[model samples]
Target: MGKIKLTINNRVVEAEDGQTVLEVARENGIHIPTLCYLKDLTGTGACRVCQVEIEGARTLCAACVYPVREGLVVKTHSVRALEARKNVVELIVSNHSKDCLSCIRNTNCELQRLCQELGVREDAYAGNKTPSTFDEVSPGIVRDTSKCVLCGRCVAACKKIQGLGILGFMDRGFKTKVGPVYDRSFNDVNCMQCGQCINVCPVGALHEKEEIHDVINAINDPHKHVIVQT
Candidate 1:
């Protein structure tokens, strides 16, 4: 198409028309954090982590989905942007169980990592911490809706990349969740157990059911529960 001139983090850059602001920013080493943006996959913009303040826009736009336009001025990490991102992470954390130390992706989880980076000491919202059950029907993966941030990466991966539309975001608002139809188990659907959902999951919400934590605990337990998976 055509070339567009945009200012990213106050630096003028030339980007192709229709190119996502995230793409242009990354190309220029401007880190606009993203979770639901998997290259060559779907850009659902469900996660607001990549949000940037665009001049003349009424609200912050998702950089991964917002197209670059001529003479666009984008602020990647303004005070407003930081607060918005921090609030987004806090909202997700509010619903999630604060068992990060026991989680499989404890140290490696992207959501946890972002929380640390964003400096959110505790969730400020006094909302409901709705408890949900875990889904361990599959062998290689576990689904925990309580920890889901509604990033939609797993949904995109299953539907766009693997061509398996087994996962979807259900319900609305605070009750919204990602799962199969009728909130059924993934195994009940046509899932292939490819583990792409786990790969794309940013939090411990979706992960391989690993006994590594239990294994470590077993060293100190006189009667430890240790069941090896084959």
Candidate 2:
């Protein structure tokens, strides 16, 4: 594709014609917070955290999916854009599980970082939360719906990277969730246990089963032969 010039946050930058606004911004050292946008995965625009203002556009556009065009003008951090992004993060956090203190992905979670960055309040916009499910039936992986942001990253990773298509969005609207078909346990499906979903999950929604206690118990057993392998 031919290179095109676009203005992001009042800064003119040249980018490929088909590149998304988020790509151009990042190439120019501009920061645009995003969720549900993973490199090499198809953009779903499921999360509006990357929304940006476009000149002459009636509504804010998701930078991750909005392709850059010649003379396109974008604002990644305008007051309007920042407020929208902050509100989006707030909604996600309001319904999210409040177990970060003990959650596996606490400090390293993308959602947690976004909350801190956007200054989202712990109790703002609080309302009914989706009924949660904790599925530990899978020996190697755990699925916690309470912390899911519905970002679709794990769904994309499982389908694209693993080609298993074992995971997907189920139900509709407020009742929607991601899981194997018919809400079946991962252990009941043909999952490869490759952990690609875990790798891409933005929150504590998906993680490997915790076995630290089991390992410690084994170590304390006098008759147990535990050989640590790196």
Candidate 3:
């Protein structure tokens, strides 16, 4: 694609045709907060945290999916854009589990970092949360629907990266969640237990089963020999 010039935050920059506004901004060191977007993965734009102001656009656009054009003007952190991002984070947090203190992905979670960045302090839109499902039947993995942000990263990784497509979104609206078909446990599915879904999950929705304590106990037992398996 040919190079095209665009103005981002009043700074003129050059980008190739077909590049999204978020890509150009990142290439130029302009920060645009995003959720549900991973490099080299298809952009879902499910999360509006990456919304930005675009000149002549009727509404704020998601930078991750908004294509850059010649002479396009974009604002990555305008007041409106920031407010929209904050509101989006707030809504996601409202329904999300509040056990961050004891959660596995507490400090490392993308959603938690976004909340801190967006200054989401209190529950702004608290209401009934989606009925959660906790599936630890799989020996190698645990699935928690409560912490899922429905970013679709795990589903994409399972299909695009692993080529298994074992995981998918179930139901609709407030009843939606990601899991194996028919609400089956991962153990009952064709899942490889490769943990690619866990790697791409932004929150604590998917994680490896806790085997550290078991390993520790075995190591402490004088008669038990712990065999490390890859």
Candidate 4:
């Protein structure tokens, strides 16, 4: 197979034919932010966070799914690309809960980090907020739907990586959410509680329910009997 030569941010690079722009850029140290993109899985291009400017192209292309071609010129940080990335982050923030200070992924959440990086000062868009019912029902995992961005990372992690098929999308546009089959609670499905879904979540939607603070205090009591390494 012939190598496809392309320019990313003014640097020339060669990639094996048929590789997506994102795969080629990643291999060459070009950092492109993504929300719903995952390896070895289907790329839906729904997030629009990985959008980049391709010379002579009428519309911005999603680097995750757009195939690279010979003589293509790509600009990852153009003004138009910046505005699109900022709007995507703002739209996600409008529907998300502003509980980052007390959330488990305060420092590590990808969405939060992107908001800071992109300087998303205001969520100009109106929110389509929906109330959550899983707060008291979820046993092993804490599911805060208010914080969900519908990125589908957890859905892919559950069905593809772990072959669990426990979580998925329910409802339709604007009201769509990643959840267990038939809109059932996580406990209703055959969840293994392996926490793989939680690890891949970019937001605070999925989290461990156990309180580490209480667990640590219980173990520190000298007079009380404590189970070690259980």
Candidate 5:
């Protein structure tokens, strides 16, 4: 693709013709927040947090996947864009499990960081969240469905890097989920234990199995001895 020149937030910037507005904006020091747009992966544009206002466009566009054209005029932080982004995030938060204090990815979660960035102080549509499901069936990984943002980064990682296709989205709508094929648990599947799913998961949905308490108990037992490695 040839070079394309565009104006972002009043500053002129140049980027490749095929580059999305989000990529160009970030390259030029303009931060467009995202949740489902992982680096080095095709953007799903599922999380509308990266929406930006473009001149002559009737609605805000998803910066993560919206291609930039020559002479394009875009506003990365316009009032309308902010409100729409905030609303999208709020809906996600409402349907999400808000137990960040005790969650595994508390301080390191992308959703939490985005909420803070957008100044979301309270839930605008709180209700019964989806039923929580905790599955530690895998010896090396834990699956927490409640914390999943449905971003599909883990699914992408498994398919692209591992090539195992061990996980995928199941069911539909509010009941949708990512898991092993045929609704089987990871313990029952041929999961390779590569931990790629844990690595790509943006929230607390996937993580290393927490066996610290078991180790501590074994250490304190009179007849038991535990060896540790870091």
Candidate 6:
């Protein structure tokens, strides 16, 4: 498609007609926060964190999926947009286990980075937390549901890229979750054990099942000098 000219935060910018508002904004160095948007994957617009106000729109639009149009005017960091994004983050944290100090992802988690960047000092929207589940039956991967933000990246990674629909979304609203079909453990499914979901997960919800702890336990055993799995 031909180039389209649009105004982003009072500055004129041009992007491909087919480009999304998020792509155009990022390409021109206009920072718009997002959570459920993974580059190259089809955006679900689930997070609502990338909402931006368009000059002619009645409500804010999700930048990741909103196609850019000529003569369009967008406000990326407007008061309404910032507040809405902040509230969205807060809601995500409401049921989220905020035990970042002990999480494996720690400073590397995308959700943690967003909290820091968005100046989320505390989670204002508190409620009953989602029950936690730690599925370690799979020899290759571990799942901690308490840390999942339901961003759907892992689901997309498994279904879209790997052609394995082993994982999927179920339920709805605050009670929603993503996991192996029928909410069964990963071991029960035909999971490829490829670690694709773990790699794309933005939080500590998924990770490799490391053996470092087993090795350490063997080293501390009083009556053991050497341990062999074979």
Instruction: Please write out the lDDT profile of model 2 over residues 1-230, one tens digit for every residue.
Output: 89889898888899998999999999999999998999989598999999999999999999999999999999888999999999998888878887989999989999888888888876778899989888999889999999999999889999999999999999998888998888899999999899999999988999999899999999999999999998
Off by over 4 Å in 3: none
lDDT of 5 at 52: 96
lDDT score of model 6?
Answer: 0.89
| Per-residue lDDT of model 3, residues 80-151, tens digit only | 999999999998888899789989998999998998898999999999999998999877999998999999
Please, what is the whole-model Cα lDDT of each candidate in the order they appear? Answer: 0.84, 0.91, 0.92, 0.85, 0.87, 0.89
lDDT of 6 by residue, 1-230 (tens): 79879999999999998999999999999999888899987588988989999998999999999999999999999999988888889888888888889888998988888888777888697779876677999879998888889989998899889998888888877678889976788898999799999989989999998898888998899988975776
Error (Å) of candidate 6 at residue 183 is 1.4
Worst 10 residues of 2 by lDDT: 115-124
Candidate 4 residue runs with Cα over 4 Å from true position: 136-138, 220-223
Q: For model 1, state the Cα shift of residue 101 in Å.
A: 0.5
Candidate 6 residue 217 C-alpha distance from true site, Å: 6.1
State how far residue 63 of model 5 sits from its true place (Å): 0.9
Alpha-carbon deviation at 112 in model 1, angstroms: 1.2
- Per-residue lDDT of candidate 4, residues 83-138 (tens digit): 99998888888878879899888998989888888898886787567665454366
Of 4 and 5, the candidate ahead on TM-score is: 5
Give per-model TM-scores. 0.86, 0.97, 0.97, 0.92, 0.92, 0.92
Local accuracy of candidate 5 as per-residue lDDT tens digits, 1-230: 78889999999999998899998999999998888888776478887889999999998899998999999999999999999988988988888888889999999998899889998889899987776567888789888888888888888899888888888888888878877876677899999889998988889888998888988898999997667788
The residue-by-residue lDDT of candidate 1 on 1-230, one tens digit each, is: 98879898789999999899999999999988776678887677877888889999999999999999899999999999989988888877788887887787888888877888889897687678765758898767789887887888888889888987889878888778888777888778888889898888888888887867767888668787666567
lDDT of 3 at 184: 89
Please tell me which model should have the higher TM-score, number 1 or number 2. 2
Clashing pairs in 3: none
**RMSD values, in order shown:** 4.2, 1.0, 1.1, 1.9, 1.8, 2.7
TM-score of 5: 0.92
Runs of candidate 6 exceeding 4 Å displacement: 215-230
Candidate 1 residues lying further than 4 Å off, grouped into runs, are 211-230
* Candidate 4: pairs in clash: none
Better of 5 and 6 by lDDT: 6
**Which pairs of residues clash in candidate 2, taking residues 3 or more apart in a chain or in different chains?**
none
Error of 1 at 98 (Å): 2.0
User: How many steric clashes does model 2 contain?
Assistant: 0
